[model samples]
Target: MFTTGYAANSATLQILMQKEDIAILDMGVHASVHEGCAFTNKKTFPHNNLEALEHILKMSESMYRTKLVIIDGVYSQEGDTSRAKEIYDLVKKYNAYLMIDDAHGVGVLGKTGRGALEDDGLLDKVDFITGTSSKTFGNLGGYVIANKKIASFLKFQSRQHIFSVTAPPSSAGIVKAIDLVDEEPIWKDKLWENINYLKTGLNDLGLDTGITCSAIIPVKIGDQNKMWDIGRILIENGVYTNPIMYPAVARKDARIRMTVTARHEKEHLDKTLNVFDDINKKNAYCEKNNNNYA
Candidate 1:
């Protein structure tokens, strides 16, 4: 295991894919994936654009010694899942490998929360699967699932893994958390209930929530300045949320990113929705063309 999820991805890719190999990625993958490909030839397709992905795969088919297509099981920003089945099929057709980073999907997707691969019935078929303990397990390590031979190679050859400190005592907590997810399915159910409720409420209020199918919801605010003002207003009113701006998203695509958890009660969500409603009504910030408030 690596110290951080970033290390797991970056270190592994750095070792397995070198100058001769090409790393084809979906644009929405985590920053870690991009950093991992620093030494490798890399190309990126627009997020979820199958046609673009196929074009790249087809073009690079005979050129690269190894081609790896990487995508996120659930995109962190847009909160949508990967088109895993279709992508996997295309990867096979091109004779390339597929890797999925399911950090945000693991404990929140599939029939038993085994993650996006399980949801798509490709759990045992994907070439590689990487995930973190920090998100759903509430711990602090990252792991990669691969064939026995590949797993052994990574454990020894990856520089970061070779020299990194052993996982802390809290590693046990991660195991327990995984068990809890299986033992108590009710939490997943509650999480979905909260997700649907909050998403519907925001949509009804004419807020742009983007195309989110996961707990990570983005309330889209086109203007960066207005987004900052709205973020401040929400915080001052006791509703904390992430104010995402350029670099995280495009300059004009600033948004407030919110994560819905099962622990949150209806009262908490209602309070949040009420605060957003009040802010929009007072400032008219939710309106598409209204930019009067300063």
Candidate 2:
């Protein structure tokens, strides 16, 4: 069993002794999995480094028979994706299993929006997949899809699944949304169009959106108060966005994160661009003039 959360990692570590453990391929900018079941038993590697992954797999073959590799499909911070196909090939070569936490990829990536594994041609090769419903699925709760054995194990042993209440009534409505994502091509298309448009716009405005290949745009502001001010200005101009400061982001690289959805049209994008332009220009002038407003 593998989990993307710290709790799951901890539980897995406890279940499998550290001495029996193998390596863990963790992203450099990924959320903390510091205190997990595999915390001490882990072999940490660079983010998206398939070469390093292969080396670790080769070294451990004599020591262990079952190898597990964990990664996220779409990273929450940078919004980029894992090289699932490359990793999947490694797993196949070594007779290992691969699990992906596709929290941000469903309905926002892939030809049919199945996620990075599908995008990278490794869907069938992956051993298991976990995705959250709160993001593009536009609902609550999370899901796990796997073979009968893993599914049965998780159903009975995953503490989160066993201890948590079942999916709510509204979750039934979400199946319709998922169906629409499958039946309607326009939603994903519009979502990508908006993503590219905003990404281009942010870059044109001299804002740095770190490695974002998806709809989640993090506009680096470099200061907490300034990031908050940027968010306030966007709101004042009728363009709502979030200010992500320290703890979530690096203290020196605070940002106003914006998500462009299928719901946003050209008018919305144009207005958002205008407001950003105004704020940046005003802020630059204030800094130059030593104005208190800056």
Candidate 3:
């Protein structure tokens, strides 16, 4: 299967594709995909660039026996999306399988938050779909959603699935989370509302939130030290945020990531912006410093 990874999932992908013999049409921004085949000849393409993916597939027709296209439904760092439908079509044309990691999209998109496949209306077209039980689902476990053939195969051959301990009793929580995503449309609506409000507010502040239309907002802060300092300051002010430092992202492209929730209200958004403004005043945070309070 082709996929993007983050920890547990990445390790599994690494074991699956151990050599350079197989071709992987990979998105440059997928961290796990990059690491999976550290020594393989990966055809790295622009993130969500369907045309680039198509080129890779065309090249693979002569370069390898099997072609795999890996992508993410909703990228974690950028909060941008992959054109799953388009990629699925491209893969079908090339007679290749497409694997998608829908970690950020699950429990957040689609009619019932079934993830990108459902959101893109190409659920049946995808060969494999993987995701975590965290994020909007608010649980702790990983899942691989696929056809019975793939499911049965993994149950027997996927090292991670076979050797790993049984999922915690919290698997029950995942069930509930899925139920919530299905039963409560208001949650998704509220989440989108918060995302729009926060993103707009940050843009109004002249902060470069970076190509994001999702709940994950990345405020580019070039310096790692500054990123950590801002995270501490925000926490002190009662608003916790994530500091993505170098290695995870490119060097000097550190960011204080913000995640908006369906539970957040107008006052919460207002206060978040207020804190950013207050911090900017003391630190002279500006575009020059790459300090975006987004």
Candidate 4:
């Protein structure tokens, strides 16, 4: 196990992918994935653009010694899932390897919550699967699933795994959390209920929620300044949310991000919707023509 999810990704890639190899990424992957590929030749395809990904794979087929395609199970910002099945098929066609980081998908997706690969029926077929204990596992550590040979290599050779301190004792809670996902399936059901309710409410109020099929929801608020203002208003009224801007998304695609949990009650969601409705009516921020909200 690695201390942080970042280390699991960055260190592993740094060791496995060399200058002679190429790391092809879906543009929406976490920042750690990009950092990991710093020493390797890297190419990125626009998020979930199968045609674009195929083109890159076809072009670089004979150029690199090792070609690995990396994508997220569930994109953190957009909250959408990667086209895992299609990508897996494409990678196989090009004789490339596939890695999926399911940090946001574990315990929140699939029949038994095995994550996106399970949902796509590619869990056993994927070359590598990396995930964090911090998200669904409710602890602090990261792990990689690989064959015995690769696992042994990473355990011994990865600098971060070799030099860094191990995860703390409290990390044992992650095991219990994993157990609960199976024991109490009700929580996952409740989480989905909350997701649908909030997403529908926001859409009904004429707010633009980007294509999200996961727990992370982004309420698109194009203007950065307006997004900050909206974020402030929501927090002031007791609805905490993140105001995402610039580097997180496109400059014109600033948004207010919220994570829906099973613990939330209908009253909490209603209050949130009411606050958003009030904000919309007062500022007309959700309207397309009102660009200048300064």
lDDT (CA) per prediction: 0.91, 0.71, 0.73, 0.91
Candidate 3's TM-score = 0.87
lDDT (Cα, tens digit) per residue for candidate 3, span 1-294: 212125445654555554544546445345655665564556778777777777777777876655667788888888888877878888898898777888888767787767767866788778767777667767666666678875666667665655556666656776787788878888998998899999888777777788986789987777788788888998999988988976778778889899998999899999999988788867755646454432
User: What is the C-alpha lDDT profile of model 1 across 1-294, one tens digit per residue?
Assistant: 788889999988998999889999999999999999999999999999999999999999899999999999999999999999999999999999999999999989999989888867999999999999988887899989999999999998998987869898869898899998999999999999999999999887778898999899999887899889989988998899999988989888889999998898999899999988888788766355442222
Better of 1 and 2 by TM-score: 1
Clashing residue pair totals per candidate (backbone < 3 A): 0, 4, 0, 0
Model 1 CA deviation exceeding 4 Å by range: 286-294
Model 3 CA deviation exceeding 4 Å by range: 1-8, 11-25, 28-30, 34-41, 287-294
Q: Please, what is the TM-score per model? A: 0.96, 0.83, 0.87, 0.96
* Model 3 residue 263 distance off true place after TM-score fit, in angstroms: 2.1
Task: Assess the local accuracy of residue 291 in candidate 4 as a C-alpha lDDT between 0 and 100.
Answer: 32
Q: Put down candidate 4 lDDT per residue, 1-294, tens digits, no spaces.
A: 899888999988998999999999999999999999999999999999999999999999999999999999999999999999999999999999999999999989999988887867899999999989888776899988899999999999999998889878888898899899999999899999999999999888877787999999999888898899999999999999988998989999999999998899999999999998888888866456443222
Q: Which pairs clash (backbone N, Cα, C closer than 3 Å) in model 4? A: none
Candidate 2 all-Cα RMSD:
4.1
